[model samples]
Target chain A: MSEPIPLLMTLAYVAVALWLGVRARGSHRMDSLEQWGVAGRSMGPVVMYLLMGAGSISAYTFMGAPGWAWSKGVPVFYVVIYLSYLALIAWYCGPRVWAFGARLGHVTQAQAVADRFESPLLGALTSLVMSIGAMAYAVLQTIGAAYILEVMSGGLLPFTLNIWLVLGTIAIYLFISGQRAIGVTNAFQGGLMLIVAWTIGLWAAHRLTGDWWFGGVFERLRDTHIDFLTLPGGLGDMSFAFWTSSIIVSMFSFQQPVWLQWMSADSAQSIRRSASWLPTYYFVILPMVVVGFIGIFSLPDLERADTVALQLAFQQMPPILVGLLGAGTLAAAMSSSEPYIHGTALTWTRDVIRPLFKLSERRTGQLARYLIFPIMLLIVGPVAMLNPGNLIMILLVGLGFAAQMLPAFIGLFVWPRATRTGVLCGLSAGFIVTALFTVVWPNPLGVHAGAWGLIVNLPLFVAVSRVTRPASDATLARFMAIVAPRRPTSRSAGEREPTSSTIT
Target chain B: MNHRLIRPATRRGKALLALFLLVILAGLWPAVLLANHAVLILGLPALAAWSCLIILASTGVMLLANRLLPLPTSITQADPTKAASGPGERVDE
Candidate 1:
C-alpha cells in the first residue's frame, strides 16, 4: 500500500503539470512564431525570474550536486560558485540580448550572431552547435526524470515507461502552448523544488544528527572525515586547478541557447530585474549539498553516488515525503528539459531549415512546432534510454561545446573589430580543441577542457580579425547604436538614429 | 527605477565592474585556498561558508549595479520598426 502512494503522488504531479500546460494557451491566439516561440515577449519579472531560475537549476542540482558532495566533498562548491556568477552574467548581458531581440526582431542567439557578421552560413553553424548542446542537456534531464520516478516508486514505474511519460507530457504541452507553457509550468515547479529541497535537506540532517542547525553534521564530519570538509575532497580529485577551472568554464558557458531565448522573452527592464534576483534562488542548492554530506556516514560506499539523496529519502523519510521528493526531482528535470527541447526545435527551424529552404515566416513557425515531436521521440528519447555517462560529466561536456561560442558573443556585444571570418575561424578552432581535449585526453594538466578551448580560441580570433576585413562601417554603426548607443551630445545628436525591423 | 543609462565609463560602473571581478576571484584558486579547511563556521564548513558568502556578495554587487546603471531609453522605450536606425539601412533578415 505504501509502495503505491509514492507512485500515485508522482502521477498526480504529472497530471497537474499536463493540466497547467494545456491551460497555458489561454487568451493568446498562438498564431505567430513570436507568440509561440517567446510568449510574444510578454513575461513579467516574477514569471521570468522563476523561469530562468528553474531552467538553470536542473536535475544536476537536484541529484548531481548532492552526489558530488557525498563523493567528493567541498569540491562540489564549484556548483554554488558558478551558479552565483551566472546571475551576474545574466544581469549584465540579459538587457542587451533582450534589446536586440525586441528591437531587431531577433528570435534566437544564432540569428543575432549571424546578423552581426552578415553570414548565413555562420548562423547555420552556430545553430547546429547549439542544437547539439541543447540535445545533450535534454537527454540528461530525461534520464534524471526517469531515475527519480524509478527510485521513488521502488522500481514499480521502471525507467523505460518513465521516459515516455516524462517526455510525452513535455512534448504535448510544448506542441500546444510553446514558451508560455514553459514559463507557467517552470514557475510552479521552481517554487515546489525550493520547498522540497529545504524540507528534505533539513529533515535528513535532523534525523541523522539530532540537530536542525547543520553544525552537528559538520562537527561529526570534521571529527570522522576531516578531508570531506576541505579541498581535494573525499576522493582527492578536486584539486585547486580542477575546482577553479571548472568554475571558470561553467561560468563562461552560462550563455546557453535556451537562456538566450528566455532573455529575449521579456522587456529589458523585466529581464534585468529578474536577473538581479535570480542568485537568491540558488540558495536552494545549500540544503541539497547538506543532504549529500549527511549521506557520508549514513550510507557510505554506495555504488552510485548520484542516488545519495534519493537513497536517504527512502531510508529516513516517510512515504509521503518520499513522494514529494520524487515530485520535486521530476519537476526539476521536466522544467529544465522543456526549454532545451523548445529551443532546439526553434533554432533548428529558424536558423537551419528555414534559411536552407527559404521558407516563409508562417511556414517556418509551423515547421518549428512540428519539429518538437521528432526531436523528443526520435533523438532525445533514444539517447536518454542509454543513460549515457555521469550526470555532472554530461553537463560539463555539453557546456564545453556551448562555451566555444564566446568569440561570437564578443562580436555581437563588445568588440566592433570582430570580423565574420575571424569569428568563424575562432569558433571552429575552439570546437576542435574542446572536442579533442574533452574526448581524447579529458582535462589535461588539471584544467577543464573547455578552458583549454578558450585559451586557443581568443587569440586566434584576435589575429584573424586583424588580418580580415571587418563588417562594413555602416553595419558597425547600426549594430553599435543598439547595443552601445552613444550619449545624446549636441554634436552627436545630429547623427542618424539606429535602424529597426518588424518581426517577420 | 531610474530610466537613464549609466555608461560603463562612469565611476559607479567601474566600481561595480571591479566588484564583480573581485567576487569571482574570491571564490577561486588562491583566494579559495585560504578557506579550504575542515573548521566549522556557524555550523557549516569554512570552505562552504566562504563560498556562500561570496555568492551573497555577488548578489549585493548586482543589485548595486542595477541601481547605478539602468538601461538607456533607446533600449527601454524604442519601437522595433521606428527606433533610431544609426547610419546604415537595416540589414536584411
Candidate 2:
C-alpha cells in the first residue's frame, strides 16, 4: 500500500468532516437537549435520506458485507435481501414516532417507549439495552476506521494510534456539533461510499479476472469454484431457517437513529419520500460484494476476509483513488459511529444516571458528553480490540442484542393488549438468552441465537400481557394512532372519531 | 371475505402479508436450491441469478406496496395542498 497518497487523502477527508462539523453549529446557542442531540428539527428530506441510508450502509456494508460475500458466499446477499425492505419498516414505524415526538417532545427511542408504556422502568430498561448495543456498535465502527488507517498506511500507523485518531475525530465533532455534524457528514459519506464501491468493484473485477469483466464475476465463480454462487453457502455454515431469521432479526435492531431522524424532519411525508430513494442508495453495496467475489480468485488464499476490498484497492487501483477509497471507507465507518456514540451517551446520562440521581435535562446533556468517552473507550473499545472474531461478528452481536427492541416497539403502537410488565419481562428474558447464545454457547441446532431469543420473547410477551391488565384506554388510543389510520375528524366538535383517519 | 378482510385497506395488508412470508421463504431455503444447477442468467450462476432477481423483485414489491398503502391523515394534517403536490412546499406551523 503506497502510504503517503492515501494518508494525505484520508487526512484531507477528515479535515473536511471537521470543517462540516464546525459549520453544522447553528446560530442559536446550544443550550437545550434538542439543539445538541437532534440539531433542532431543522433537517430536510435530503439530509434525512443520507442520514438514514448511512445509518445502515456503514463500515459493515463497505467492509463487513464484501468480507461476508468472500467468506459466506451467497448468504452474503442476505444483507441485500434484509435491507431492501428496511425503509418500509421505518416508513410504517417512523411517522407515528414523529407525531409522538412532535406532540409530546420526545427525542430518544427510550423516551418514546417509556412515555407510551407509562413506565419509567421500561424506559430505563430500554436505555440500558440500547446503550450497550449502541456503544458496542461504535466500538466496531472505531475498529473499522482503525483497520482502514492501518491498511491505507501499510502499518505505518499502529492499531493503537489509529483507533485514537479515528475515535478522537468522531468524539470531537460529536462533542461540539452533535447531530448536525453527523447529518452533514452522513450526506457526504453516503455519496462517497456509493462512488467508491462502484469504482473499486469495477476496477477489481476487470483487473483480476479479465475473463468476463465486472458483470461476470459470479459467473466466473460458477465456472471455476461453483459453491460461491449458491445459498446455504460454501460450507453450509447457515441453514435457510438461520438466514431467514437472521434477516428478520437485523431488520429490527437499534433503529433509534432512524426514528430520531424521522422526528427531526419537517414532516412524516418527508420521511417516506426520503426513504423511497433508499433502495437505490443501498444497491451501491452490491458492487462492493462483487469486489469481494473478484477477490476470492484474484487474491487467492488471502489471509483475512475483511482485508479483501482494501487489498484489491491497494494492489490494482491508482494511488490517489486508493487514498480516496480509504477516506470513503472511513466515511462509511465514522458516519454511523457518530450517532451510536451520541446515542449511547444520551441513554447513559438520561436513563441510567439521571434516574438514579434525578439530574435535569440541560445538565444531563452536558454530563452525557463527558460520559460518552469512557463508555466508548473503556467498555466497548476494549471488546473490539480483543478482535472478537470478525467485523460481521461484532456488528451482529450489537444488532442481535438490539433486535430485542423489536417486540416492544411493535407492541407499542400495534398491539393494544401489550403491557409494560410483559414487555419488560420479554426484553429481559430475550436479551439474556441472546447473550448466552451469542457469547457463551450457541444452540446445537444451528439457528441464530437472536432468532432463538425471539422464539422465547414473543410468546412470553403475549402470555405475560394476557395475564396482566392492559394499560389505560387513554394510553392504548394514543399509541394506536400509527397503524390504525388517523381518527375521523369532527368538523363541529373538532374531535377525531376513533375509527377513521379522514377529516370530516 | 373472512374477518381478515374487515376493510379494503386490510385486504391489501393481507396480500402484502402473504408476499412478506413468501419473500422470507424465497430469501432462504428451497428457493436457493436453484443455485445447485449449472445454468446461467446474465452471467450469474443460475442460483445467483435467481437470488439477485429475488432481491430486485423484493424491492419492487416493497415500493409497490408502499404506493398502495393508505395515505395517513397526518400527511394532510401537516398541510392539505402540500400533501397532494408531493414534498417540496414549505408548510407553516
Candidate 3:
C-alpha cells in the first residue's frame, strides 16, 4: 500500500493497447494503398477528431508538457494557447485537404503540393526534407517511450529493449492494419490519456490545498521568481523571445505527416465536426500544470525535468493510478508513432519511389511496405543511443523547419498567380532562414528564429508570386477548385475522385 | 435540409461535449464520498466500490451519448460518377 500501483496497471494498459491493435489488424484491408495509409477516407467526425487530437498530444502531451510545466513554471501554458487557433486552422485547412484529397487523390502532404505545382521534382524534394525531419522526430518519441519505461520499472528492463519493443510493436501493427488501426487506437488512447491527465491534475491540486481551489497553487507559483503563470518572468532575454516565437512559429510551421488525417475524414462536415471539439479537448491539460506545480514542491531536487511525471506518480500516487499514468504515456507515444511510421512509408513511396521510377499502383504499394522496415531501423538505433540534451533547442529547430511548408500550402489556396518558380524561391528562402535560425543564432534578436524567418518568408512568397508569371489559367483553376467553398462536380472543367493511380 | 442541429447548432457543440465530459469525470472522484463503508483501493483515500461504479457509469454514458447523437452529413465523400477526364481529376471506382 505504501508504494504506488503504477507498474501492474501500466502493464495491463499496455496489454490492452496491444490487444486492440491486434484486433484491428484482423479487420484490416491492406489490399489497397489507401486503406494502408489513409484509413480508407471513411473515418467519421468523432473518430477523426480523436485521432488528430490524440496524434497531436503525443509523448509531448504526456511527458514534454508536464516537464515544461515543471521547469518553466506557468509560462509553458503558452503551448496550449494555440488550441483554439489550431481548431480554426483545422476547420479551414482540414476541409480543403478533403476536397483536394478527393479531387487530386492525395495521400500525403508532399502529394498535395506536388499535384498543385504540377512538378514531381518539387514533390520529391518536399517529401525528402519532411521525411528526414519526421524520422528524427519519431526517433525522439521512441526514445521518450523507452525513457518512461526505464523509470517506471525502476531499471528492471533496459531502456534499449523498451524502445525496441514499444516502437517495433507499433510499427509492425501499423504495417498490418494501417490507418484503421491508428484511428480506433487513437480514440481509445485519447480518452484514456484525458482521464489520467485530469486525475493527476485534480489529485495534486487537492493534496496541496486540501481542496480543489487554485489559491494555494497560485500562491506557490507566484512565490517562484519564474511564476510560469505569467509572461516575462524577469528573464529579459529568453522569456519574451520564447513566448512570442513559439506562438507564431508553431502556429505557422508545424506540418507533421499526420495532417493528412483531415483527408481521411468521411466527409467535409466531419472536418468541421472534428475541428470544433478537438481543440477544446485540450482542457484536460490545465491539471497537468497543477501537477507540475506539485512537482516543484514535492520533488524539489529532481535531476531531469522530463522525469517529473514519473517521480510524482511513483512517489505519491497509488499503484493502479501509476499504471493508469503509464497507459496514458503509452497512448501518447503509440497514437503519435503509428501515424508517423504510416506517413513515413507514404512519403517514401510517393515522393521518392514514384518520381524516379514512375511505378504502377500495385508496385507502389509494395515498395511502400519495403520502405517501412528500414525507416523503423533508422529511428530505433540512433535515437536509443542519444541522450536528451538541449531538448528545447531540438524542439525549436524542428518547429522552424516545419514552418517552411506553410507558405507553399497557403500560396496554393489564396494566390492563383503563385508560380512554380516563386514557390521554389519561397521555400528556399524560408528553409535557409529557418536553418540559420536553428543552427547559428538558436535565439536571435530576443525572438524565436522561426518566427523571424516566417516574417521574412511570408513577404518573399507574396513578392515572388506577384512578380512571376502565373501558371496557365486552367492550371490555376484546377488548384483553386480544391480550395473553393463548393465541391466540384465532374462537369467542372477538371474534377476527379481520388484513386490508386493519381500521380500525387 | 435543416442544415443545423437542434437549436441551430452553434459552432461550439464539440467543445461543449468535451467540457461536459470533463465535469462528469471530475465529479466521479468526489462521488467516492457517496459510497457506504468506504474501503480504500489502490492506496488512495477513496472507496473502491464507488470507483468501479463511476468507471462503468461514465463509460456507459459516453457510449450512450455516442449512439444517440445524430451524425453530420459528409458531402465530399458521396461518390457517384459523371464520366469525364482531366489531369489529377477524381474518378469514382
Candidate 4:
C-alpha cells in the first residue's frame, strides 16, 4: 500500500468528520443542562439512528469483532445476540425512558436513574462505575487505534501516535462541538465504516487465496489444541452453557448506553425506524467474521489474533485498499472509544461533579468537555505503558462489568417496590460477587463471573424490592408519565401518537 | 406445496429469511476454505456483486416492512398546527 495514499485517506476521513462537526455546531444553543447533554431534547429519528449506530459500530465492529471471529470462529457472532436483546428492550422500555427524559428533563443516564428511583447516591455511584468502565474501555480503543496506525506504518510510526492522533483530533472536535459533534461525527463514521467494511470483506475474500480449501491452515489449527471450529477445544475451553450465558449477560449489559442513545432521539418513532435498519449495521460483524476466518486461513502462525486484519490488508491488498481498510479500522476504534470517553465525561459531570458542587449547566457542560482530556490520558496512557497482550480479553472483562449494571437499572424501571437501600445492596452485592468470581477463578463451574453475579444479583433484587417500601406513588407516576407512551392527552384525545423513531 | 414454496410472513418468515442468509454464507465457507475458486455471481468473481445485491434488496424490503408495520408514536410530536415555538425548533436553535 502506498504510504501517501493511506495517509491521505486518513486525512480525508478526518476532513469529512470535521466538516460534519462544523455543520452541527449551530445546533448547540440550549440554555438548560438537559438540552446540552441530550442535544436539546430534539434529536429526530434520522440523527438518532446515525448517532446511535456510530456510538455502537465502533472499533469493535471493525477490529475486535472480526479479530475474535478470526481467533474463535462462530462464537463472535454471539455478540449480535446482544443487539437482538437490545432491540427487544428498546421496543418495550425505550418509549418510557424517552418520555421520562423529555418530561422530567433527564440529560444523563445518572439523572434518569436517580430521578426514577429518587436517590442521589445511586446516581453518583452508577455514574462512577460507568465512568471507570468506560475509561478503561476507551483507552483500549485508543490502544487499538494506535496499533492500527503502527501497523499501517509497518512499525515506523511507533504505534503510539495512533492513540495520540485519535485523542487529539477527537479532543478538538469534542471540545468545539460537544455531543452535537459526537453525534454528527458518529453518523458519518458509522456510514463510512459500513461501506468500507463490506468493501474490505468482499475484496479480501475474493482476492486473497481465492476460495481454496484451507487445508494447510486446518492442519495448523488441528495440530493445536483447538478444533478451530468448536468450543471446549480440547478439554479446558469454556462450556457451551457458560459461553451462552456469558454472551447473554455481556450483551444485556451493553443495553444501557445503547438505550441512553435512544433517549437522544427527536422522536420515539425514530427509534423504531432506526431499529428496523440498525440491525443491518450489525451485519458488518458477519463480514468481519469472514475476514477473521480468512485471516486464520491466510496467516496460520500469527502470534496475535487481533493484528490479523492489519497484516493481511497491508501485505496482500493494494495500497489504496489498505488505506481504506486502515480508515475503517480506525472508524471502528473511534466509534467505540469516542462515545465511551464522551459518555464517561458526561456521566461524571452530571452524576458526580454537578450534584456534588452544585455547578451551573454551562459550567457543568464545560467541565464535561475538559474532563475528556484527563480521561483520554487515562484511557490511552495505561495501555501504552502496559501493552496488554490480549485487548479482546480486556474488552470482554469490561463487558462483564458493564453487564452488572442491568439488574440495578431494571429495578429502577419496573420494580416500583425497589428502594434506594435495596438497590444499593443489590449493586454492592453484584459488584463484589462479579469482582470476586473474575479475580479468583477461570469461572466457577464454567460460567462467567458475570453470570454468577447476575445469578446472585437478581434474586437479591427480588428479595430486596419485596421486603422494602416502594418509591412514592408521586415519583412512580411522574416517571411513568414520562416513560409510558400514551399520555392521557394523546390517548383520549385521539391524537397521532408521538413517533418513537428518535435514535442518536 | 404452497406453504413449502411460499414462506410464511409470521415471525417464522423473518427468522427464515435470516436463516437463509446464514445458510448461504455458511455454505460459501467451504469454498472459501478449500476450493480456491473465486465466488461467482453470473460467472463473475466478485463477492461484493453478490453481497451488495443482498444488502440493497434486503434493505429495501426492511424499509418497506417497517413503513407498513403499525409502530408506536414518536416521543415528541411536532405539529405545525400547534405553532408552539420551543427552543428545540432550530436545528441550529
Candidate 5:
C-alpha cells in the first residue's frame, strides 16, 4: 500500500492520454476552424459514439452522483432519469443538427441559431450565456479531478498542484490536436471508465455487505435509513416537485454547445446510430450510485461526500485497485473537460469574436487555437482552484443556464414561425428568471428554478411570436428545406430538386 | 405487428416516442410515488428496480426504432463541393 504505486499509476494514465491525443493529430491537418473545432466533420460512428457517450457522462457521474447518493439518497436517481431522456433527445435532434452543419458549415451551435434568425446580436448573446455554462462545467470537472489525485496520492499531490496539472495536460493536447484529440482520448478513457466503475462498484458492495448484488445494500439502508430509499430523500430537500423539474430541465440542457460539435459527424446516419446506443452507457451510473450507498455505512461522517468513493477505496481496497479508481475518475473528468474547453474557445472566437469584429474565417480559426491557453490557465484553472461550489449543484446551475437556449433550438429545428425577437426576448427572460430563482429566491415552492423559468419562458415566447414579425421567408425556407422538406410536387418532379442554393 | 393499420416506420417512431414519454412519467413524481417503497425487487429497492426496468425499456425501444426506420440518405450529398472542402467555407455569407 505504498503511496508511490497510486501516484505512479495515475501518472501513467495521464501519459497514455497525452500519447493518444498526439497520435490522433497524425490523421488530419488541423488547419481550419472546422478542422480544429469539429475534426473537419469527418468522425465516423465509433469515434462519435464513444466521444459523445463519454463527454455526456462527466465528472458529475463519477463524483457528483456518488456524492448525492451518499448525502441526499434516492434523489440522486434523478440523474438516471434525465440521462435516459438525454439520449432520446439526441436521437431526435442529432440528425437535424448534423444535416444543418454539413450543408451550411456550422461548427458551433450559436452559428446555426444566428443564421436561422439572421441576427448576429442574438448569436453573440447566445455565445455569452453558453460560455458561462461551459465555464461552470469545466470548473466542476477540474475540482473533481484534483480531489481524486490528491486522495489517491495519499495527500502527496496537493489539490493546488493537481488542479494545474489537470488543466495543463488538457490544454497541451487540446491546443495541438483539437477535436481529433478529444475523439481518440475520449474513446480510450470511456472504455477505461466503464471497466473501472463496474469493478469498484461490485468490489465495494461485496466488501461492505458480503454480497455483489445491490439488493442487500438497499435492504440494509431501508431498515436503518428509510428516507434514503424514497423521494424527498435523506435530506428532505429533494421533494417530488423538485426532482421532476430537475429531470425536465436536464433533458433540455443536453443541447450544450459542445454536443453540437460532437454531432458534426461525417453523416447524419452516424449521429443517429450513435445516439440510439448511447443510453446503454448510463449503466455506468448504477455501479457508482451503489458505491455511494455503500459509503453511507462504511465511511460515515465523511467531510466531503463527493470523495466518499475514493475515501472508501483507500481504507479498504488494495493499492492497485485504489490507483485504478484514481485513473478512472480522472478519465471521466478529463474526457468531459476537453470538449468544453475546446467548445468554449470555438464558441467565443467563431460566434462572438468573428461575427462581432467581421474577422475572416482563417483569422477566426487561428484565434480560437490560441484562445485555448488563456481559457484554461486564466479562467477555468483559477476558478477551479477556488472550489466555488459543490459538484452536483455546480452541474445543475450550468445545465439550467444552457436550458435557456430552448427557444433558439425551436427556431433552428422545429418551429419556423419563431421570430428573432420572440427568441431573443424569451431567452433573455428565461436566463434572468432562472438566475434570480437559482441565486436569490432559490427553488420556490419546491420546484426547480429552471422549471419556473421555462413556465414563464414558453408562454411569453409564443405570445411574442404571435405578434412580432418572423424571419424572412427566404431564411425560414432555408431552414425548413433542410429540416422538414416538402414532398416534391408532380410539376416540379422533373426539375433538379431545390437544394440549399435555392433559398440563398 | 400491424403494418396494414399504420406505416411500420411511423408506428415504430410513435411507439418509441410513447415509450420515452412513459419512462419520463414513470420516473417522475406521481408515478414514481407508486413505487417509492423500501420493498426490494430482484435485489434492489422498488423505485431503483423500476428505474432500471425503464432504462432497459428505453434502450430496447431505441434499438427497435433504429432497425425499423430506413437509413436516411446522406444530407452531405446536397452540397458535394462544399462537403469536400471541409466544413470551413461559409455557404450563405
Candidate 6:
C-alpha cells in the first residue's frame, strides 16, 4: 500500500540520521570547547558550504511555500530573492564574523557582542533574544515535520504522536554529537532536498501544463488567474509595500544563531565558497512554486491550502516515491531544527548562566547539555502540538524578532559610536513596536509591523549612541579591522588599521 | 572558483557593489508597486521574472566582486589558535 512505502522510507531516513549522528564524533577529539561546540572551527569548504546553505532552507520551503503559492501566487517568488540577498549578506558579514570569532575565541553570536562592547549584560540580552527566536523556529520545524508525516501517511499517523517522535529523534541525535553531526547530516539532507524538490517541481510542471508542456499554463493563467500572476499578492492579501518590506527584513534577518555555523568553518574562504552557490539553491523553490501554481488549477476545493502540495504528489506521482517525498520533507525539518536546539543550548550556557555564575568551559558545556531536553520537551514540544497559528505566522514573528538584533550587529562593526545603552534601548523599542504592530495593533497601515518598528529602531540606535560615550578606541580597533574595510566604497586609513595600543 | 569574500577597492569591485545596491534598492517597498505586472514569461508573470533577474544579476556581481579582492589570504579563514595569538598580522592605527 502507498501508506507503508512512505512510512518505511521515513524510518530508513531516520536510521541514517541517527547513524550519521553517532559516527559524527569520529577522529576529532571533541574534548575542547571549540571542538564540541563548533566542530573545532575546522569545517572545510564542502562541509561549511552545505551547513550554511542548508540552514537557510527549512521545511517551510517545502511545506509553507507551496501553500503560499497555492493561495497567494506570485508573491511566493519572494523566497528566492530574499535567500539570494542572504547569500550576498554572508559574503559581506560571514567573513567578518568568522574573523572575530577566530581571533577572540568566541563561539557564539552573543559572545562576539559581549567582547566587542565589553558588556556581559548586552551579550546575555542578545542571546536571550536569539533564544526566543530559536525556540519558535524549532517549534515551527516540529509542526512542519509532523504535518508532513501525518499528511503523507493518510491519517495513519497522527499529529500529536508525530510531534513527540520527531522532536525526540532530533533531540537524541543533537545531544549525542553536537555540531559535527549536524554538519555531516546537512550534506546528505541538503543534497536530498535539492533533488527531490527539482524532481517533484519539474514533474508537476510538465504534467499540469500537459500538451502545452513548456509553459502553456502561463497563457491560461493570464487569461483566468491574472491576479495570481500579478503581485501585491493574489486577491490583494498582501500589499506591494508588504512584499518589498518583507524581502528587506528577511534578507538581513540571517542574524540568527546560525552565525555560529559561520564561525565553525575552517576558513572564511569556505563560507565565501558556499555563498557563491547559494542562489542556485534558492532555485529549489522554483519547483515548489510550479507545483503550487499547478495546485491552484487542480486542487481548488481543498480545505487548507498547505495540504495542496502533498495531496497533488500523492494523487499524481507514483506511490513508491510518495514515501521518499515524505522523508525529504522530514529532512528539511530536521536539518534546521537540530541546529536551533543546539544553538539554544549554547546561548543558555554561554550568554545567560555562565556569565552570571562564572562556570568553567567544561561545566558550562555540561549545563548546556542539561538544558537541551527541557527546551525541547517543555517549550518547543508543547508549541508544536498546540500552535497559536499556521507555520508561516510563527516563522514571520520569529523573523521579526531576529531582525531586532540587526542594529546592534551593524553597530558592532560599522559605527564606532554605537554604545551599549544605544543598542539596548534600540533593541527593546524595536521589539515592542514590532510586537505591538504584529499581534495587537494588526495591519499597521498595511505594512509589516517589523518595517514600521525598524523606522523607530534605527534612529533610536543612532540617537542613543550619539548622546552616549563611544567605545574606547582600543575596543573599536580590534573588532572593526576586518569588516570596516569590507564596506563598499569606504577606504579611510583609520577604518583599515587598528589603534596602536591594541594587538599591533 | 576563487573562494574569497567581496571587498570594495578597485573600480570594478566598486562598480559591482554599486550594481548590487542599485538592484536591492530597486526591490524595496516603493518599487513593489512597479513590480506587480501581468505580463507572462515562461509561465511566470513579469514580476516573478523580475525577481529572478535581480537574484541572477546580484549573484553575478557578488562572484565578480569576490574574485577581485586584493588580499586572497585575508579572505580565507585563519586557524583559530594562530589567529587568536598572532599580533604581527594585526593592524596598527
- Give Cα distance to truth, residue B44, candidate 1, Å: 0.9
Model 2: runs farther than 4 Å from truth? Answer: A1-3, A209-213, A380-397, A482-504, B1-25, B30-38, B46-55, B62-67, B75-93
A237-341 in candidate 6: lDDT tens per residue? 677777777787787675545687887888887777777666767777777776777888899888888777788888888766677678888999989888898
Better of 2 and 3 by DockQ: 2
Query: What is candidate 6's fraction of native contacts?
Result: 0.37
lDDT of 3 by residue, A1-504 (tens): 334356566666667777776677566557555667777777898888788778878787777767776776545555564444465556556766776666656667777677666677777777777765566667777777777677677777688888877877776667677777788788899889889888887877787778774456655555653334444432233255565566566656446455668867877678767775665676656666567667877887889777787788887877777777887887787777777777878877866777677776567766776667777777545655565575445655666767777767765655455666777877788778877877887667666777777777778877887777755556556655445423232333222421111101
Candidate 6 CAPRI classification by DockQ:
acceptable
Best by lDDT: 1
Top candidate on DockQ is: 1
Query: Candidates 1 and 6: which is better by DockQ?
Result: 1
lDDT of 5 by residue, B1-93 (tens): 000111112445556556667767887879988878878889887777777876777677667767765434545354422643332233224
lDDT of each: 0.79, 0.69, 0.63, 0.61, 0.77, 0.73
Write down the worst ten-residue block by lDDT for model 1 chain A.
Answer: A495-504
Q: What range of 10 consecutive residues in model 2 chain A has the weakest lDDT sum?
A: A495-504
lDDT of 4 by residue, B1-93 (tens): 000111223453355446434433321333223312233333222332333343444445445545544333433452212322232211111
lDDT of 6 at A241: 74
- Candidate 6's error at A171, in angstroms? 2.0
Comparing candidate 1 with candidate 4, which one achieves the higher lDDT?
1
Candidate order by decreasing TM-score? 1, 5, 6, 2, 3, 4
Pairwise TM-score winner, candidates 5 and 6: 5
| Residue A286, candidate 3: alpha-carbon lDDT | 62
**How does model 3 fare in lDDT?**
0.63
lDDT of 4 by residue, A1-504 (tens): 336777677657766776776666685663334544556546666776667666766677767666776666545544554554354445445555665565555657777667666777777887877665676677777777777777766666676666677788887776666667777788878777778877887777666545433333333444452444444322225356665576557555743356457666666676666655664566666556667767876777888777777778877888888888888878777777777777777888877888778877578877877787887676556565477776545555556667777755665454445667677777678777777777667478878888887888777877787777766666665543333333322222323333212111
Model 1, position A452: C-alpha lDDT score: 92
lDDT (tens digit, per residue) of candidate 2 on A341-415? 877777666666776777776887778767767876786567667766665554556667788777677666566
TM-score, first chain, each model: 0.94, 0.92, 0.91, 0.87, 0.94, 0.93
- Supply every candidate's count of residue pairs whose N, Cα or C atoms clash at under 3 angstroms: 7, 1, 17, 43, 1, 4
Query: Against the true two-chain complex, what DockQ does each candidate achieve?
Result: 0.33, 0.16, 0.05, 0.07, 0.27, 0.27
Query: What DockQ would candidate 1 receive versus the native complex?
Result: 0.33
